[model samples]
Target: MRNWESFLRGLLISLVALVGCWLVAGPTAHAATSAPQTPTSPPTSILGINLTGGFTQQPIDSNVISGHSVTLSAKGTRNILETATNPLGSRKYVWWESTDGGSTYQQVGTNSTTYTFTAPEVTKDTPLMFQCEYDFTGLGLFYNEWSRIATVTVTPDRVPTTDIQVSADSNTLYNGESTTVHATLTPDNATDPVTWTSSNPSLASVDAYGNVTAANTSSTMDGTANDHGTVTITGTSNGRSDSTKITVGALQNVTVNEGSDATFTLNNLPDGMTVANWYKVDDGTTTALNSTASSYTVSKTTVGGDNGTAYYATLNYTVNGSTKTVNTNAALLTVNKSGLLSLTAVPNFNFGSTDVASVSQDNTTLENLDEATSGSNYDGNDNGELSVMDSRETGGDWTLTASLSPFALSDGDTGQLSAVILDLYDPTARLDENIPATNTATKIYTSSDYDGQTFDVTDSQLSFAADPKITAGDYQSTVTWTLSVAPS
Candidate 1:
């Protein structure tokens, strides 16, 4: 019984050993059917895209920058969506880029990688695109697509401008004269055209091409001879515009009277000037008229005078083109009436006389020499006195005379008479103190018959030469005196 039991135990041990060996071997060929299944379709698929969400063309992004845009990025897509998984290997992703918008595509990179592309031209019509995919064939073939489309835009550059000029034929415009002006408009950019406009059409007019014409219209320009108008021209081009202005006028009218009324028209005068007009009236009328000439004559008309018949005149002028007028401005003229003054005279007047030159000899010699004894009485001396002869006074036309009359002078002794007029009216008068000879007085003569000589005096009375011819008449002259003496 012991031998049989040992044999059976050995067999049981061999069976256990065989089972352990089989369990130690690798999976069977059919083990794959019992493995966990891998998905055939990807969890996410790309349907559309957003060019700029967080993606940007700018290199930095702490804060948004101006004048820049974000680059293309995908929209409605999940970056973490599941792709087919392989038991032994990691899944890889692929990406593509396109320059012509999204018309066509090309492979750019592989594996789960970010795709970068050369920036497209920034223009209004430029196009660009991007796409991505994953290869999951190890477990199950699948793809997660992401894409974006875009266009480039370009900015603009420009500005506006204008030009102005003026011209006239003459510096001076008459009251009835006119002139023309030309203005040319040039723009900075030829492509951006300009339109022309004016401010005052009444004062002046400008054509479409900028030709200006001056119209004879009334104006209120300060300091202008005549009120006139002004013109403003504007040029517009692109998005901007500019303007300029001009003034017009003529010389003002010259005035004659202060309170006179008259409307006078002038022609052919310089512009922006002020002057006065000459005015005059004819005898027998109160109406005054302005002369086209610079000077004018006055007639007996308009003057408020009696039947005596007299004439008056006036001139007109303007100052700084002002309205103030000077009445009957008689700047240059004189009126005379006859017999306005009278005259008188006084004559002889005993002008004091002085002793002419004289020489006396003493003949009182003791007649008989005392030695001869007889004492004779003989003594003689000549006593002479000279006096002014007469005094005459007259009121109506009278005359005063001065002369050198010689009398009792030695006939052949050769004597002269010189009378120095000391005083003509009063003999005892203080002549030098009261009246003196004037350098400007006209001289009168002592002759009766009025002679051509208004004055005459003896050259040398001592020599008894010719007596000065004297006369008196309507002596129209200043006061005068003479020096005279007679030789004895």
Candidate 2:
């Protein structure tokens, strides 16, 4: 019986030790399985938990088109709950949209890890941004997730009204001359590109690539001149477009005149153009053209030798891809090789002011008038000598003094005298009185009276003129007398 008791006591002690070991081992294993997972290190305590997540942001430009949207996403990372059995207790996600480029955030979505935002309207040259946040909480621990702010830009796709510009705002072309009509498209915003086109194909045509060509139209077209036509050009860029109209014409009336060079200039011409003269005539000798332009003169060497008249040539120009002509007024000039005496008068007389003086007299004639053999000769055929004099102030009564010093004055020896006054003070000054004892006073002079007549000489008088209210300090005009000899 005593031996049985001893064995029972030993067995009981062994059973107690085994139960203690089992309890401790079970608890240790459970703790290992339940602990939070950390990539860097083991958790110091199971009670403490830490979680981390990530968010991604995509910029959805606030200025994008109506159908466009921006996206933002949150990704889970460094999850404290490693196993499905140990999941977080709660999850929260928030998304925000910012119209002011993320300056201020407004809630757009909640309770989601990802969000997509779309803009309603966009302004030109504006910026936009968006952002989101995620939170995870379980077992008395907090996890945070954030997304980088997404950014986008807003811009207008439509173009505003714009003005059309030309590379050469003005152009000039002669008959049969061709030039490019360079038109440029301009947008209200300098940053935008432009498109160009033309309206009137008959008068002028323009290509999409900004090339201008010429067209033909009869005098029958309405709103167009008998010899001229108009072309319309349209320019568009973005959503805006504009049109411009230009006129085209022909050199209807061209003529030959006496000029320094063989060149002639067109009158009433289109912008940015010059006149070119072409003369084809069979002169006894070959004809040479003048050096100066705007008008043409027969070559002094060829004028008298040719019996028949030379006709002026036509002028042509291309504007905006179409041809236009410049009309020149007809001017008939004849060169006489015979030596003759002629006269021309240069008058500088003031009817309003009492200060009157005769610059020249009637016997101012030129001798030996003939066609010019040399260009430098002043008194040659087409050229005449110029004799000038100052106003003769001989008291209140002005007298025209003329002298035939070297030659006798004959009935047919005609001459002209002109007077010019310097510094005409008041162009509006009235005639003080007629001078000299005659039925009707032949001469009028400047008025000293303040209560004199006023005249409108804005277009007629020179720029250096005082108001009608005359001042004593202001001087009258300087007297300049000129003499010109005409072909006898």
lDDT of 2: 0.36
Q: What is the lDDT of residue 402 in candidate 2?
A: 23
- Candidate 2 differs from the real structure by a C-alpha RMSD in angstroms, to one decimal, of 32.6
Worst 10 residues of 1 by lDDT: 55-64
Stretches of candidate 1 exceeding 4 Å from the true structure: 1-180, 185-201, 207-250, 253-290, 294-488
Q: Report the C-alpha lDDT of model 1 over 232-317, residue by residue, as the tens digit.
A: 66666544566666543332323322112223233332222223454322233334344544334442111112112212122233
lDDT of 2 by residue, 1-488 (tens): 99999999999999889867644543121111111122122111110112212321221212234335644444333333332323635556666666654446667677775576564465555565555555444333344445556554545553343554544232322212222333333432332444566565644555433444443323231212232334566666555666655544433322222121232233554333444554433432223343325455444222333324433333454434555554332222333322221122222322232221211212111222133332211231232222112121121321222221111112324331122212222234432221211122222332221111222222122212122322222222222222232222
Clash totals, every prediction: 45, 53
**What lDDT is reached at residue 466 by model 2?**
23
- Structural similarity to truth (TM-score) of each candidate: 0.19, 0.23
